[model samples]
Target chain A: MDYVLTTNALCKNYRHFKALNGFSMHVPKGAIYGFVGKNGAGKTTLIRLICGLQEPTAGDYTLYGINNTDKKIKDSRRRIGAVVETPSIYLNMTAEENLKEQYRILGLPSFADIPELLKLVGLEDTGRKKAKNFSLGMRQRLGIAIALCGDPDFLVLDEPINGLDPQGIIEVRELILKLNRQKQITVLISSHILDELSRLATHYGFIDKGRLVKEISARDLENACRKCIRLEVSDMKVFTRVMDSLRLEYHVLSDTQADIFTKETITRLVLSLAKEGCEVLSLTERDESLESYYVSLIGGTEHE
Target chain B: MNKLLSANFTRLKKDVFLKLCIIFMFAIGALLPVLDYHVMITYEFPRYIDESFFSYTSFMVILFSAFCSLFIGTEYSDGTIRNKLIVGHKRMDIYLSNLTACIIAGVIMCIAYLIPYLLTGIPLLGFFIVDNISTIWIFLGCNLVLLIALAAIFTLVSMLNQNKALSAVICILGLFVLLMLGAMIEDGLNQPEYFEDYAYMDPETKELVIEPSTANPYYIRGTQRQIYEFLSDFLPGSQIIRLSAMDAPSPEILAMYSGIIAVATTSLGIFFFGKEDIK
Candidate 1:
């Protein structure tokens, strides 16, 4: 697995409060890695540390295989674009002007791509209007546009759709998906909006109390949270044999309990189990959402 | 670093506050000379071009204080400083680029004042009346260095403090405080050593009596006076006041002091700014 960003025992402390305590995670080369945690769970702190906005108190991180302490890490950093906490854009400048300014900062040879970049974020028509006049959504999009000016392979956004309306959230979500799928840009987006994040992330890292509790691929998480029929059979040996014979996927939980992951008819299955002398004691349907999985992973109150 | 500097200069060119400051400086430069010319013609009094030539120093101090504050403050207020860092520009480069842009702006403002000052003053009041041409050159050189030092000090204040409004208030108020302190020190240094003795008819009794000379109470002498002299030459505020009056006893030393202040403040600002945790 090629990782674009990797942190090892990364720690950040503000006076007495430890923002990131031995935190560690790996963002693969082409994944929309959703960083999930409650408010003040070191999401922004980690973003700041990786963005070079703040230095870690202990441990280190690597960008594109370059260690944080390496001077060449700056060269590595040029490959990344990030909007930390808020969209870092000049409010007095128009969207086009903001992108031009970023191009100048990046020492680009020309402004030829300014229009295309603006259009990429859906801000191409904001001609002459300063960013101060832009709506919250427009400004967020402009921030993304500015971040894209460098044509970076890695993009980091901190709460990108934090204060947007539903329409705005949809626009940003579609943009992220487009950036990841079409451009193949690796995105590390930190947001507390689990439902929105679940829509875009190919992978997830659940953070709690400054430590990453789990990092799982979206496919694996989906499987873990998949809908299935819970069953308590009279005999696990007979149930496994019947399930295998019927070509049904099942996970054995105990000597008498299992979860059948198929849509086969229950009456026929019961009759077959009866024929095999394996009686069904209990049956119920179970479906777990990403939000519930997050809750269970972090062991916090619901809706946190 | 070059890229950051290019970006800063591009921003500086479009800065409305800076354009206003430049216009105000040119207006002051062009008007003060005309006013002095009006007085010379109306009152039949002699006025030298040097009188108002260095006057731009005082205005530069105030304008640069305000300009550097708001300019750098806008970065923090708008959060654009993060763009530079996120793009992998070194903190040292960011600080230096800002300082360079500000110093150039300060120089441009000075030139904006000088163009009119020279155009009007040379034709009306004539060239410098000082004994040595080098004195004029020294003052001019030291004044330019003084502007650089002023930019450095204001940049330090603005860069270290993230809040734009607060840094502007501090820079403006800080200038006034330094000026007041400089004026007080200059006043102490200007006191005469002693009062002359004289004989006069007493108002109460019609008798003439001779009195001996007594030491001037306000006189600052010895080491205290030396410290005061060094300060008048060292501090940017005092240097501005002295240069405006064309009373710099050691222009080279003043320029050196300005150089030291410029280097010191910039070093301190960059060091602290590097350690600052940007949000």
Candidate 2:
């Protein structure tokens, strides 16, 4: 795969605490790479290192094949636009004014793209509204607009959908999808919102304790997630005894609920439960979602 | 660097706080001479335009303190500094561009005061009455350099600190402390070496009694006096006071001190700012 970003054992230390410890990952070109980690899991730290907001204590990363230590790395960075932690924008300026300031910073020849950029972020109709007065969603969109100013092919966003209403979340989600699909801009999104991430990410990197637990494509992850039949029974002991006697692959989720990973006939299982005097309250086939996959992969508190 | 500077200047044009400072300086500039002219008429004494000419130095110091802190602090508070960094601008360039913008603002504030002061004062009072034309030139040169030094100091404070409110408080409070220190040093330096001996009629004895002169304990002399003199020229607050009174013993030395301060603070600021981690 052609990679736009690749890291080799990157590390960041804040005084005595290590935020990122020998963490590494690869983001393929034109792929929406979901950076998944619980809070304090070094997701933001990695983004900061890549965005040049903070320097790593050890190792290095390459942007567009340019090593970070190389003098020409800055030129490679010019192809990236990032909103690390929060949207970096001038709140006192209007949305249009903010873009113009960014344009000036990027040294674009003119302000011609300002309107098109605003419209792309759904902020064009906000004629004279200063960013300070913008809603959380509007501000976030404006931040994305600012990130999109120089027509960068790679975009990095840290918790882009955080603290938004449902409508706002949907808007931002649609916007991200549009950017990825239509513009083909490679996006590296660091978020703990797995369900939202699942909808957009083509590939994912699950992180825990400042290290990458796994990096898998969405297709591989989908195939890896087991299809199980969730069963709620009256007598948990009887159900376990029968499952043990049958030697079925199973996981106990609760006292009365269990997941059987094997493909068993419903009639036989029901008859066996009936003969054991255990009532089957419900049984349903379910696919393990990204949330459950993350939980199983990291195996800590849910969402940490 | 040029792109960052152009962007910074664009933001500088819309900064309301800076505009307010400029207007306030101009108003104070125009009013100072008018008030001194009133004093001249009411008290029946001559007051030269030169007396109030450099009076804007103190106000300029305060305004620059407030302006630089807010101006640079806004970048950190609003997170806009990251925009520049992520767009491939070097941290050194960002620091230098901010310093340049602040220095320009300071110079503009000086001009704002000068335009009104010159327009109002010269017609009412008169041209500079100093012994030589060079003194005025010297004062102007020293004051301009002093402004740059002050801008550098405040920019250093604001750039190193990420908190806008805290930086503003520190810069403003820091200005007052320096001003007070300068005033105290100047006061100590101004003390007479000895009290003059005097003869006075004793009310009880009705006889003239002569008293011997005594040395002033507050008088700063020797190496201590030299240190005080250097500080009075070195500190921006002291430079303002000295320039205002037109009593700079050596304007060349004052300008040199200002140059040193500008270079030192800027070097220190850029070094630390380069190491700072932006969120």
User: Which is the leading candidate under TM-score?
Assistant: 1
Docking class of 1: high
Inter-residue clash pairs, candidate 1? none
The TM-score obtained by model 1 is 0.96
lDDT of 2 by residue, A97-211 (tens): 9999999999999999898999988998999889999999999999999999888999999999999999999999999999999999999999999989999999999988789
Model 2 chain B: ten consecutive residues of lowest lDDT = B233-242
Question: Which residues of candidate 2, in runs, are more than 4 Å off?
Answer: A226-286, A301-304
Report the lDDT of model 1 for residue B150: 86
Whole-structure CA lDDT of model 1: 0.92
User: lDDT values of the candidates?
Assistant: 0.92, 0.91
User: What is residue B47's positional error in candidate 2, in angstroms?
Assistant: 0.5
Q: B268 in model 1: Cα distance from truth in Å?
A: 2.1
How many clashing pairs per prediction, in order?
A: 0, 0
